[model samples]
Target: MNDARPPLPAPPRPVRRAAAALALAAVAGSAQATDVFRLEGFGAVSRSMGGVATAQDVGPAGMMTNPATLSLLQAGHTLMGGLDLVTTDIEVQDQATGARVSSGHHGSNRGPYVAPELAYAQRVGAWTFGVGAFAQGGLGTEYGSSSFLSRATGGLDTGLDNSSRLLVLNIPLAASFKVNEALTVGAGIDAMWQGLNLNLLLGADQVGSLIGASRVSGALLPVLGGLPDLRGAHFSLTRNSPLASGINAWGHAERIGMTYQLRPDTRLGAAFTTRSHMADMEGRATLTAVDGVAGQIPLNGNLKIRDFQMPAVLNLGVSHTVSERLQVAADLSRVFWSRVMKDIKVGFVSDGGGDLNILLPQDYKDQNVLAVGAAYQWDARWTWRGGFRIADQALRGSTLFAVIPATPRKHLSAGFGYAVSPAASVDLAWSHAFREHLDNTSLPNTSAPIGVNHAQDNATIAFTWRF
Candidate 1:
C-alpha cells in the first residue's frame, strides 16, 4: 500500500506575476444587471431617459452610448462623475424537496453593489475629445455553505460554498468631428478588463456527465474512471482569495457612431460596438475530490478560463423636441449574445500530473431592447424625466438558469435634474426591474426540479462641472 504523492507543478513566471497584479488591482464590488448581465444605462441622464442617449446630448457619458453626441456639448471643458447603487433580490427553490435559498437572506449579503463612472471631454474648434472609465456589466450570485446546493454524499450538507462572480470594466478614448451643419461622426477604442471567480460542487453523476461531453486529455482520466462505486463521489473547486477573482483577463474593442439632423428640432443616431478580444484568464485553484474507493484527495492546480468575451451591440435611436419645454427620445438595440456566451471552457492542470477540461453550456440567445423616454422643463432651474424599457430574456429554461439567474424583462425609471449654478448641475435617477420567475426542468444529469426568481432596484447620481 503506497500512499506517497508527487510534488505539484509550479506555474510559469509570467502567469504568476500576472496573477499577482490582478489580485492587487481587483475591486471589492461586483456589477450585475438589467440587460442580461448588462446595465440599462451608463449615467444618470442616460438612465433617466431609458438609456436613450444615441440622439441626445448626455454630456461625457455619451462616450459609452453614441460618441457623436459629444459634438453637442457646450464649447468648453466638461467633467462628469457618477455612481450607481444596485440592490438585487434572488430566490432559489428545490421544487422536489421544497428547500429554498434567497440572496441577502440567511446571512448572505450580496446587495448594494456599487458601480462608478467618470468622464472628461473638451470641445475645441470643430472637434470634441473625450476619455472615461465605465463599469460595463456582469453576473454574480452567492449561496452560502449551508444551502441545499452544497449537499454531498447521502444528502448531507458538506459545508461547501457555491458562488460565482464576474465583473467588466472599460476605459475609452473617443473623439467626435462635426463634418457639416447637419451631421457628426465619432469613433472610439476601449481597453477592457474582465474578472471571474467560481466555487462549485458537483456530484459524481454530474462529474461523469461533464467528462463524457468535455474534451478530455492527459493521463489521469484512466485512474479516475477505474474506481468502483462512484455514487458517493464529489468534485469541488475553491478559490484562494475572497477579495479577488480566481482568474482575470484583459481585452480591447472598438466603436463607431454618427448623428444626423433630420430637421431643425429632430435628430437620428446610430452606433456599432464590436465584440471584445480577450486573452485567457489564469489563476490558482484548489481542487478536491471525494470518492467511495479513493477516499478524499486534495490537489493544487492552475486554472485557465478560455473564450470568455463580451458580445457586439448595435443601437439605433431618435430624439425630437416637440416644444420649448418638452422633448422625447426612443432607442432600439440588439445584443449578439449567442456568439460569445454559448459555452464557457475551463481547464485545470494539477501540479502532480495530467489535466482536466470542462465545458459548461450556457446556451444564451440573442437579446433585443426597446426604450422610450420623455423630459419636461418645470422651471428655469428644474427639469423632470421619465422612461420605460423592455427586453427579451437571454437564457433558456435549464439548470444553468438556476446557477446564474439574470433574467429580468421590464424596467421603469424616473429622475430629475437641478441646476446649481451657471457652471454646475446635478442629476439623479431611480429604476426598478420587475420580478421574473423561471422553472428549471432541463437538468442535464439529474431530474431535480428548480425554480428561480430575480428582481432589482437601482439609483444613480451624477454631477457635472463645466469650465
Candidate 2:
C-alpha cells in the first residue's frame, strides 16, 4: 500500500487573513427589512399597531421610536425580548434575453430571515432609564450561480454568484424625565454597527460607463486610459467564501423626543434622530479582470466604502383614546434618503501599486411615510390590534435597484396581546407587504428594460416581564 498521500491544499494567506478579520467582527450574517431598508416596526406591539410607538407605551422598544414614551413604563423593572421572521418573494426578468430568475427565498433550501431584539428598563421617582439592542434596518437579495444574471463572456454562464446584503444594528441608552403631570422629555445616544457583503459582475461597457461618470483624477486614470480595448472585459468582486465575511464598520448617533398631553384622552409626540457618523467600511476583496487583453487577472486588494451612512429621520404622532376600551394612533415621518444615498463611493487599493475609484449613482428621493393603527380591549386578557402603513418607493428603476430591491409600498398588519399573568405578557403580530413591480430603464448600455418584483410577509412575537 502506498504510504504517501497528497497533502491537502490550503487557502491562500490573504484569504485566511480576510476570513479571520471578518470572524473578529462578530457580526451576524443575513437580515432583510421593509420600508426601503427599514423595518416597518421594531416590536410586536409596535408592528401590530402599524409602527405607532411615538406616543404609545410599547415597553422598552420606545428607545428606538420615542424615548419619552419610556416614562409610561410601570414602576420598578421591566424586561422585553422579541424575534422577527421575514419572508420575501422576489423575481427578476431580463426582458432582452427573455430569461427569469427567482431569489433564494423561494426555494426550499432557504428559510425566512430572522432578527432579534432585547431591552431592559427601570423607573425610579420621576425618571425612566432604558437600554436595548435593535436591528435598525437593512436590505439583501441572492441569485443562484446558474441564473441568467450570472452570465459573462457573451451570454455564457460563468457560474458566478450575485448577491448583496446590508445590515445595521443599534444599541441605545436612554433616559426620560416626567416634567410635570402633562409632559415628558427624553434623549438618547445610539452606538451602531453596520455590515455589508456584495458579489457583483459588470460588463466591460458598464465598467467603462462607471469610470467615465466617476471622479477619477489620480495616477490611476492614465494607467486605465492606456489599457487595451475593454470591449470584452468584465469586472467582478467575488470571493470563494460566503457573504458573511465581507466588511463592517461602527458609528453613533443621537435622538431627542418629547411627549405632551394635549388632553386627558389625547397625547402628541415628536422625535428626531440624527444621521449616523460611521467610519469607512474596510475589508479584503478579490477583484477579477476578465477577457480582453487582461486575460483573467485576479487582484487582491483592500476595499474602502466611503460616505455610506443612514439618513436622518423626523417623526410626529398623535394618540387618542376613543373610549374606555378603544385607542387609536397615527404617525407621519420623513426620511432624508437623498442626502446620504446620492452615490455609492468605493475605492480599491491592491498590493501591487494598483488603485481605482468607482462611483455608482443612487439618486434616492426623500420618503414620506404615514402610519395608522387602532387597538381594542377584548375582555380582560386579550387586546386586538390592526394597522396600515404606506410609503412611496424611493429608488428609481435601474440595474442596481434590481439587485437591492427594497420597494414595498404598502403594508397591512394585525395582532393580539395576551396577559399571561399580572407581571408577564405576550404580544404577537403579522404583517404583509403587497407586491410591487419596477422597470429597469436605466441599465448601462442596454435599452431593454428589466422587470423586478418584490413582496414580503413578516411575523413578530415578544415577551415582556415586569417586576
Candidate 3:
C-alpha cells in the first residue's frame, strides 16, 4: 500500500495564555480581578516579537493586528494559526499583616483558546479586496475554593478571601478595500461576552434607607447539634448597592482603519476600535452557616449590575524598507482606561428606581505602548525577525487597587519564519514580561495604608502561513 498521511488540524490555540495572564495579572490583583484583567493582542506569533509590524503587508491576521496592512498584500491566499498557554497564580491581600493572604486564594484560567485566520487578496486592475476572521480577544479565570467563599462571607468580617470566578470571550470579523495604489481602508465588528462570580460580605451597609424592620422573626444565627447556646447573634445589613447582580449576554466593539504608502519605501497606518459595553447581570447571594458557624446573610438582596467598557485605542505605525532584503517597522498606541474608570454607572431595571451606587477608582492612568521590529532573509526559504515593547504606567495612585494592585509592565520578544516550498512559511515566536509588582495594601481603618508588592514572568509561541 502507498504511504498516506492525512492532513492535521491547525495549531491548538492562537491566544498565548502565558502572555495573556502576565498582562492580566499585571493589570490588577485579587480584589478587583474582574475589572483590571483584559485579554487583547492575540496571534502572539506576529505581535509577540514586534509591535505588530506585519499590519501593512499582513493579510488575514492583519485584520486583527492592523487592518490597514491588508492593502499591502502581494496578491495571494494565506492562513495563520497559533496557541496561547496562559496560567496565572494570583493572591489576595491579608488585612491584618498586610501580606499575601493565601496562595490558594488565587485566580487561575485556561482553555477556550483558538485563533484561526484566512485571507485572500487578488488585484483586479488597481483595486484589491479581502476578508478575515480571528478570535481577537477573550479570557477566563476560576478563582478561590468553594469553602473559601462560604467562610469569608459567613464571618462578621470577610476580608478579600471570598471565592471569585470570571470569564470573557470575543470573536471579530473584518474586511478591507484598496482604494488606490497607496491607500486602503478597512472595518471590523467584535462580538464579546463576560461573566463574574462573587460571594456575600457580612456587613456592607446599615440599611439606613431601607423601609422594612431591622429584626425578623427567626434567629439571625444558626443552630448547631449539642451546642444550644452556640448560635450567637448576627446582623443583616441592607443590600442597597445596585452593582451586585450577574451579567450574561452578548455585546460588540467596532474597528476602523486606514493605511497609505508614503514616498516609495515608506508606509503609514492608523486605526481605532470603539469601546465595549456589558449591561447588568442577574444572580443571587445568601449568608449560609451553622451554630456559631453561620449567619443569616441576604443572597438575593436586590439587583446587581456592572459594565466594563474597553477603552478606545489609537494606533499609529510606520514601516520603511532600508534595502532590497531589509525592512523595519515601528508602532505607537494608546489605551484610554480613564474613560470608564470613575464615570462608569450601573442601574437597576426591576427596582422602583432608587439611587444605589458606589465609588470606583476613576483615577485610571493612561497607557502607552511602543514597538519596533525588522525582518531579514538569509536565503529564499529562511527569514529572521525580532522586536520589543515598552508599556506605559498601568497602576494609578493609592486607593487605586486595594484588593488587586496591578503593576507596570515591559516585554522582550523574538521570532523566526521558514519558507515551505514556494507558497508557505511557518513562523515561531517567544516573549517574556518583566513586571514590578507595585505596593497594594490597605487596612480596615488604617489612616495611612501600607503597601503589598509582587512580580511576574511569562512566555509565548506562534506560527504563520502564506500561499
Candidate 4:
C-alpha cells in the first residue's frame, strides 16, 4: 500500500537548501520591524542596516534582509550588537468640539524600541555560520481621558490602551561554500522564538449620565432624561491589557544567498528568504472593565491568534572601494508586507464570554527600500561610517485603527564609527521622522467634524559595540 508517506521527498539539494535558509532568516525582517517613524524603503537602510554587509554595499543592514551575510564577516569569530532609542509625539481630537488635545501619554523614550542585537560568525573552511538575537517589532498606543478621546468616552472610558512585544531570537546554522575564487554561496536554517503580549479594554456606558436631565412620561426625571436602567449602553472593552503578561512563540526559517566579486575591489550579493506560515499564534489577552453602574471586572482570556504567513523578502546589495581609504555601498530591497498583513480570520477566547471569533482587517501594504552608505578607514586604528534611508507608511487616510492614529513619514539620519583599536569599535548614529497630524476617529457632532491627525515625530540614537 502507498502508506509509506509517499517516500519523503529527497532532501533539498545543497544549493536549494541554501536559498531556503536565507529566506527563512528574513522571516521577521520587514518595515514593521523598524522604529515608529522610520520606513524601510521597508527594511531599507537606517541605522540597523549598517551592522551587516551585503554585496549591495549599502553597509550592514543588508544582512538583515538575507543570510548570505556570514560570508562578509572579516574572519575568525566576530560579535556585533547595538541599542536603539526612539520617541513619538501623538494626538487625538474631539470632532464635536473641534477640540484637539495632546495625548500627554503620547510618546516616551521606550517606543519603536531599544532593539538589542547580537550576531557572531565563525569561518569553517570556506563556509560561514552565524547566530543572532534581536526584536523585530512590537508596538501599541494608549490614549487616556487626558486627550479629547477621554471626553468622548464618558469617565465611562478610561482611555485607549494596547501594547505588545515580539522578539525574534534567531539561531542560524549555515555553511558557505566558495563556488569559485570570485563567488560564494551560503544557506542556513533560522530557529526563531516569537513572543507577544496583548492588552485591550472594552467599555460600558450609563444612560443617566449620557442625556443629563429629562422628563419621564408626565413626571420630571432626575439628571439627563435617561431611566435607571434605560438604554443599556455597555462598551465592554476587550482589555488587551494583562495583569502580568506571559506568552511566547517558536518557529523555523530557511534562507539562501550568493555573493560574487564583480571586480578586484567590488562585490555583489543577493539573498532570498522564505516566509513563515504561522501554524498557530496562541496566546492570552487579559481584560478589565467597569460593568454598568459600578463594578470592576477581572478577566483572563486564552488567545491563539491563528496561523498566518509572515512574508517573504528579496534583497540585493553592492559594495565598492574607491581607494584604500574610502568604501561605498548601496542596496535595494522589497518586503511583501501586503502578504504579511493579509486579511485573515481571527478567533479570541476567554473564560466566560470573550471575543469568540472575529474577522479583523489586515490593513497593511507592501514596501520597498533604498539604502546608501560609506565607511572610511582613517588609519590603522581609526574607522568612520555614515548612511541614510527612507521608509513608507502602511496606513492611508481611512483605517479602523485610526483611533491609534498613525501617519506616514520621512526620516533623515547620519552616523560615525570610532575604533578604539583593531579589537574594539563603537558606533553612534541618529535619525528623525516627521508626520503630519489629523484626527480621523473624531466623528463630528454639530460642533465638531470628524478628522484624523497623525502629527507625529521621532528621534533616535543607536550605539553599537563590535569586537
Using TM-score, give the best candidate's number.
Answer: 1
- Mark the regions of model 3 whose C-alpha exceeds 4 Å error after superposition: 1-40, 53-55, 89-98, 101-168, 197-246, 277-298, 301-304, 343-359, 400-408, 441-467
- lDDT at residue 170 of model 2 (Cα atoms): 91
- How does model 4 fare in lDDT? 0.46
In angstroms, the error of model 3 at 313 is 0.6
Best candidate (score: lDDT): 1
Instruction: Tell how far residue 144 is off in model 1, in angstroms.
Output: 0.2
How many clashes (backbone atoms < 3 Å, residues ≥3 apart in a chain or on different chains) does model 3 have?
21
User: Which has the better TM-score: candidate 3, or candidate 4?
Assistant: 4
Relative to the true structure, candidate 2 has a C-alpha RMSD (angstroms) of 15.0
**Cα lDDT computed for each candidate against the true fold:** 0.75, 0.75, 0.46, 0.46
Choose 2 or 4, whichever is better by TM-score.
Answer: 2
Error of 1 at 179 (Å): 0.8
Report the lDDT tens digits of candidate 1 across residue range 260-325.
Answer: 999999999999999899999888886666565555566688889898989999999999987655
TM-score per prediction, in order, is 0.88, 0.87, 0.67, 0.69
Order of the predicted models by lDDT, top scorer first: 1, 2, 4, 3
